[model samples]
Target chain A: MADTDSSQRVQEILTQATEELKSIKVPNDDQLEYDLGNLLVSNNNTLDETLTRDPEKIDSYLHNLARDSIQALLNRVWELPSERIDSDIYATLPKPTTRLPREKPVPKPRPPTKWEKYAREKGINNRKKDKKVWDDVLKRWVPRFGYRKIAAEKEKNWVKEVPSNADPFEDQFAKAAEMKKENVAKNEFQRLRNIAKNKKIKVPSVGVTGNEYASKNELSMAMHHAKHATASRGKFQPELPNEKKVKGLGKKRKIEFTTGSGQVEKKRNIEVLEKMDKPSLNLDGAIHKEIRDENVAMDLKRKGGKVYGRRSKMGGRHRTKSDHKSLKLGTGFQGKGKGKGKGKGKPKGKPNVGAKKKIGGPKMQGKGRPAGKGKMKGKGKGK
Target chain B: MRPLKNEETVLVFTKLKKYIGSNVRALLERSDGLYCFRLHNGRIYYVKEDIMKFAATLPRDNIVSLGVCFGKITKGGKFLLHITALDFLHPYCQNKIWIKESAEQNFMYGNHVYKSGLSRISENTPKYAGVVVLSSKDIPLGFGVAAKATAECRHADPMDIICFHQADIGEYVRNEEALI
Candidate 1:
C-alpha cells in the first residue's frame, strides 16, 4: 500500500511540473491572425510591456515572439489540403488577397478609324468569309486571295479573240496585265489615304493640284519642296545661269539690321525692350509648386506624424493636429505658440502681412525651402 | 532602306502566310519591341524598328543588308522566301514533310524529294501548299511546296516527285553571292 501511494504522489508531481511550464507564457487568443497562404500574420495586440521596455532582454524577447508567430502560421499551413506533385508533396497556396498597384499605367484605348465609327453608327456587322473558296473552273478549293489565287487565272490566258474593228497587232495580254497593275496601285493609294486619315496627318497631294491650277502661294511651296528633293538635298545642284533667288526660300532672314545708322538701331532696341516689358509669368513654376505641396500633404497623411521628419517652420516645433488645421486655413505659420524658443524666426524673403501672405512662404519658393539662403544660413540648430 | 509600301506589305505577308497560316499574327505583334518589314534595294528584310532607325542614319548605298532577309521582291513582283528564312519558318510552318535518311543528301544537293524519299508527311497537307522539309530526325533541312496532296501521296509512284525543291541548304554554298 505504501508503494502504490508513493507512485501516485510521483505522478501528481510530474503533472504539476508540466502545468507550471505551460503557465509561464499565456497565449493571447487575440494576439495574431494568420494568412498561411501569403505567409502573412497581422498582430493586433500590443507588444508585451515587460519584454519590449526591458533594454537588455528586448532582442531575445522579440526573436521568441516572431518565432511563436511563425510557428502558429506554419501550423495553420499544415492543416491545409496537400497533394503530391512530381514525387513531392506540396501544399497548394490560395490566391493572395492583397492587390498590388500596377507597374505600368493603364493602356489608352485605340482611337476608332473612320470606317469603324461609321459602321458602329450604322449597326453594320462584318461577316467573315472562309479563306479558301470553291473554284468552278479549276474544280478545286483555292485561296480567295494571295498566292496561286483564282484571280490569277486571267493572266494565264494565252490566246484572245479580237473584234473585227480592233487592230490585230495589239497585244491583249499586255493590256490585261497593265489593267491589273493599275488596280493594285489604286488599292495601295486608297490604303495609304485611309492610314493618313486615321492618324490625323495631312493627306499628301495626289496630282490634283498642279502649277497651272494651283494658287501662287501653293505653287511656290511646291517649288520650294521640289528644289530640296535632290539626292544631296539641293546642296550640289548645278545652278542655272542668271537664275534669281526665290524670296522666302532656304533659311528665314535672321534679325536683319537696317543699312541706316543710329536711328534704326535705337528703334530695334526700343521694340525689344517693349517685348520684354510684357507680363510673361512662368506659370509652369507655380504649377510645379502646387503639385509638390499636394504630394507632401499626401505623405504627411500617410505617415501620420511628420512631413519628411523635419522640424516645422515654427522653429523646431513638431507639427500638431492644430498646425494642419491652420495650414488648411492658409495660416500655416500662425499656429498656437507660433514662435517659442527661436527669436522671431519668421520665414525669410516673405513678410507676413494682413491677409495677403496667407499662401505659405515655403510653397511660394517652388521647393519646400526658404528662398535667399544667404540671409537664413545656420538657421537649423541640430535636432 | 525604307518602310515597305502598303502593297509590298500585303505581298510579303501573303507569301509568309502561305507557310505559317494564321500564325502570321504572332510575327507582327510581339511584346519585346516594334518589328517592321523594310525594303532595301530589291530584298525584303524583317527588321526590328530600333535597328532600322540606326541603319537609316547610314547612306542608302552603304548598307548591304539589315535584319533577316526573308526574301527578294523580284522584278516580276513575286516574293520568294529564301533558305536563310528557314529558322524563322521552321517553328511556324503549318505543313511539313519529313524525308528519309537515304534522301537527305539528295535534298541538300537541291534535288526534288521523290515519293520513296518521303518517310512521313503531315496529314491533310494540300497540294502546292508551302511546306517545311525536315530530316528523318525532325530537324529542318529546307522548305518547299508539296507537289502532291496528303491523299494523293498514298498512291503515288516511287519515281514521282513528292515535293518541289524551292530552296535548300546547298544554296548557302552554290548561290552564296545571289542570296544577299
Candidate 2:
C-alpha cells in the first residue's frame, strides 16, 4: 500500500510535466547547451525518496540522470558527436528541396511577327489595345423568350399584396407551416422510436426520458447536430422538394379557380350534370326544379350572370355594368326566343326564293370560262 | 558541423537567447566554429537549418514565436528536439521515472511502457505532466507521456498501458526513432 501510494505520486508528476513540455520552444544554441547541462543535473532530483534518502547522493544522482536524459535528447534531435565536429552541416540539415543548376540557362528571344515588323517599319505603336465591342449588346446578342418572367408577372398579379418589411413566415399560419417542416425529420425519428418502443425493439435509449429506443444512426446523427438549433444566421432555406419535381400539380389546383380554364370546365360539368339521371335543381331559376348537386350548384352560382339585378363577381364577374360583355371574338350573346325566320336555330335552314342557278349572271360557266393551264396536259413536247 | 562565424550568428543567437534562456547566450559567447553537440553516445544531426528557419519566423520586434513550434517552410521535416527544447524549461521535468529492466526492452522497441513496469516514480509528479524515462540501471530511456498523475497511477492497476508514447528510444546506437 505504501509502495503504491509513492508510485501514484510519481505518475502524476510525469504526466503533468510531459503535457506542459510537449508544446514547442524554438530558441537554441547556448540555451540548448545550458539546458543540456541543467538537464544532466536535475533529472533524478525531483523524487521525494531520493531527496530524503541521502542528501549527498541526491545531487549526484540528479546530475547523472540529467546528463543521460540530455544525452538521449541530443542524440534524438541533433545527431551531434560528444566531442567531434562534422564538416557537412548541410547533410545534417534538411536538404534543400530543389536541385541547383550548374549554370543559369539563357532564354532565347522570339522572332518578330509580320505585324510587329510592319509596325516597327511604319513607325507606328503596336502596344495600345484595340477597341472592343464586347460590351455592346448589338454584337454577340442572344434572344431570350422570357417565358418564366411573363409567368412570374402573372403570378405577382395573383398575390395582389406582399408585405415588404415583414417576413411571410412571421405570421402565425406561416410560422406553423415552417415549424412543421423543421420538426418533420425529428418527428419522423421519434415516430420510429415510439413504434420500436411499443414493439419492444431491443435498443437502449441514451438520451431524453422514456423507454424510446435509440438506434446507432440516430445517436450518431444527434451527435453531429445540436438539438433544436435555429437557422438564425441567414435566410432560412426550407427543405422543400423542388418545384420542377411537382410540375403540373398547381394546374390541377387552378382548375376550379375562375382563371383561364373555368368557363370550359363549367360547360363540361353542366353537360355531365345534364346526363345524370337523378336531376338536380337549377339555382338559376329554370322551370325544371330538382335536388341540386353541389358542384352543379356552384357552377350555376358562377354562371348566374345577374344576381338580384346586380352583377355578381362569381366567375365571369363584371366590376362595373359596362364591362359585362364576353371578351372572346367568336360568339355574341343571344336572347331566348323561338325564331321562325332568321333569329335562331340555324335560321330554319332557309331557302332563298329568287335564287336561280348562278351560271351566266356574274358567275362563270364552263362555256364562257377558259380552262386553267395544266403543266402535264401534254400540249407541249414531252420531256 | 562546421562552426558558423560569430558575426553571422550573433543576431540569431541573441534572438534565440531571449527565448530558451541565458545559458544559451553564454554558450554562444564561448563558441568556436569547430565541434557540434554529441547526443546519446554520438550521432551526426541533420535539419539544423530548421532551427535557423524557426528563429527567422519570429518577429524582429518581439519574440512572438518563442514557445511555438512551426513546421518547416516546406513540410516533411518535423523533429522531436523542437518540442523537447521547451520541455527543457518545463518545471515538472525535475522528476524521472525509471522503467523496470524487462520494460526497458519493450520501451527500446518503440512500444509504450506500461505503468506496471514503472520501477521508480517521483512523489511530486502531477497529472498529465511530461517526464524523462530511464532504465532501472539509471540510463535515460527517452521522453514519455504519463497517463495520469503519479499519485493516481500508484492506486490504479499495474496492467494499464499508462505511459503514452512520445519519443523513440536510442542509447548505445541510433535507431529509426532517432531519425526525427
Candidate 3:
C-alpha cells in the first residue's frame, strides 16, 4: 500500500511539471493588444531568451503563446452575443474596424432621359400609381394598362352619334377606332423619340421646311460630308464636345455583311440570279405613247378642231368604211385642186389595204376608190 | 481570318456552284463537320468550324493560309477560281469532258480543246455548261465550259473549239505568282 501511494505522488508531480511547462508567461502582460472581431492579437512583449535560443524548446513555447492569445480572443468574443442558427450555437462577430481597400471605383450615376429631365425642370415628382383601378361599369378593379384594361373606350361603344357635318353613311365607330389607333401610335412615337434623344441618336426630321438650305439639318449634313471628304474618311478629324452619334454625321454605315454560313448568301445569290434571268419588259415607251396620244386628242379638242377619226394608238389599224370614203373624197378633191397631190396622197391612203388585196395593181384600174373587182370593171367600162 | 462578307460569300458560292451546281450546299455543310468560308487577304478559305475557331486566335500575320483555298477575290471584284479547288470540284462536277492522249499536252498549255482532241463527252451536256476536263485515263487535268452541246459536237469540224479553257493544272507553274 505504501509503494502504490508513493507511485501516485510521483505521477502527480510529473503532470504538474508538464502543466507548468505548457503555460506561457511573458513580461509586461498587459502590453499585448488584440482585436477579437478580426481574430488578431499583437504581442509586443519581449520573448524569453531560454526558449527562443534552444531549437528543441522553440516550437512548444511559441505554440503555448498562440494558444493563450487565442483563448483570450475567444473569451472576449463569447461575452458579446450568442445566436441559434440552423440549430447550432454561434457567437455573433462584431463589425470589423479595419477599412479595406475597394476592388473597383464607385460607379457613375446614369444620365437622365429626356422625360426625366423635363420632369425635373418642371418640378414634377414621380409618384407610383396603383396598377389596378376601380371600374364603375364593370364594378371590379381593372389594370390601368394592358390585359382587360378600359383602353380605346370610344371604340368599345357599339353605337356612335354622327355629327351633322359628317356623312350620314360614314361608319362613325370605325372612325373613332382609327382616331384612337392614331393617338396610340403618336404616343408610342413620342416615347421612342425620347429614348432616342437620351441615347444621343439623332431623330429623323418630321418634315422638310421650305427654307431647308439655311436649316440646321442642311448645315450638319454639309459638315458631315466635308468631314468624310478626307483621305482617312474623317477618322483623324477633331471631334466637337457633346457630339451626338447621329448616323451619317462622320459615321460609316455599320453594314452587317451577312457572315458566311453560306446559306443566306446562297439564297440571296440565287434570288438575284433568278431575278436577273426573268424577262422584265420595260413598258415605259408604250405608256408614254398613250399619254402623248391622249394629250394630242385633248389639244385638238381644245382648239375646236374635228378629230380625224378613232386612231388605234397601239399599232392596230381599225379604220371604218366612212373613214376610207372620207379619205378618198378628200384626196380626190385635193388632187383636182393640186395636180400631183392625188398621186402622192392617194397611194398613202389606199396602198396598205388595196395592195395587200392585189385589187388596185395598176393606177389606170382605179384611183382613191375601194378595191373591188366588179366595181372596178364596171367603172372602167363606163370610163 | 474573318467570316466572308455577303458579296464575297455570294461570289465564292456562285463560282463554286458553276462547277458543282447545287452541290455547293454539300461543301458548306458536310457529314464530317460544319465548314465555313473565311476571307484572308482576298483568298477564300473553306475551313472546318473547329479549325476556323482555333485559327481565329492566331495573329493574322502569322497565318499564311488555312483549310482549302478555293479561290481569291480580285481587287476588280471578280472571283478567280484557283486550281486548288479542283479537289472539291471533281467529285461533284455535273458534266465532264475527256480528251485524247495526243492532245493532253495541248490542253496543258492552256489552249482551248478542239474537236479532234475530244475523245468522249458526257451525254446530254448542255452548251456553255461548266464541265471538268479529264485525260483519256480519267484524271482531271482542269475544268472549262462546254463550247458546244453533246449533239452539236458530232458534226463539228476538227478545228472547231470544243471546250473553252477557264483554268488548268498547268497554271500552277505558268501563273504561279498570281495563284494563292
* Best prediction by DockQ: 3
Worst 10 residues of 3 chain B by lDDT: B25-34
State each model's C-alpha RMSD to the native: 43.8, 39.9, 25.1
Better TM-score candidate (2, 3): 3
Off by over 4 Å in 1: A1-383
> With candidate 3 superimposed using the best TM-score fit, by how many Å does residue B27's alpha carbon deviate from the native?
3.4
Candidate 1's displacement at residue A172, Å, is 80
- TM-score, candidate 3, is 0.39
Residue runs of model 2 more than 4 Å from their true location after superposition: A1-102, A107-383, B1-95, B170-180
Interface RMSD for all numbered candidates: 24.6, 46.8, 4.8
TM-score: the better of candidates 1 and 3: 3
Error of 1 at A205 (Å): 18
Cα lDDT, all candidates: 0.70, 0.43, 0.70
Report lDDT (Cα) of residue B76, candidate 3.
Answer: 96
Q: Who wins the TM-score comparison?
A: 3
Candidate 2 residue B68 C-alpha distance from true site, Å = 17
By lDDT, the better pick of 1 and 2 is 1
Q: Which lDDT tens digits does candidate 2 get at residues A45-91?
A: 24568564897888876674455556555543454333332222321
TM-score of chain B of each: 0.97, 0.51, 0.92
Which residue pairs in model 1 clash with each other? none
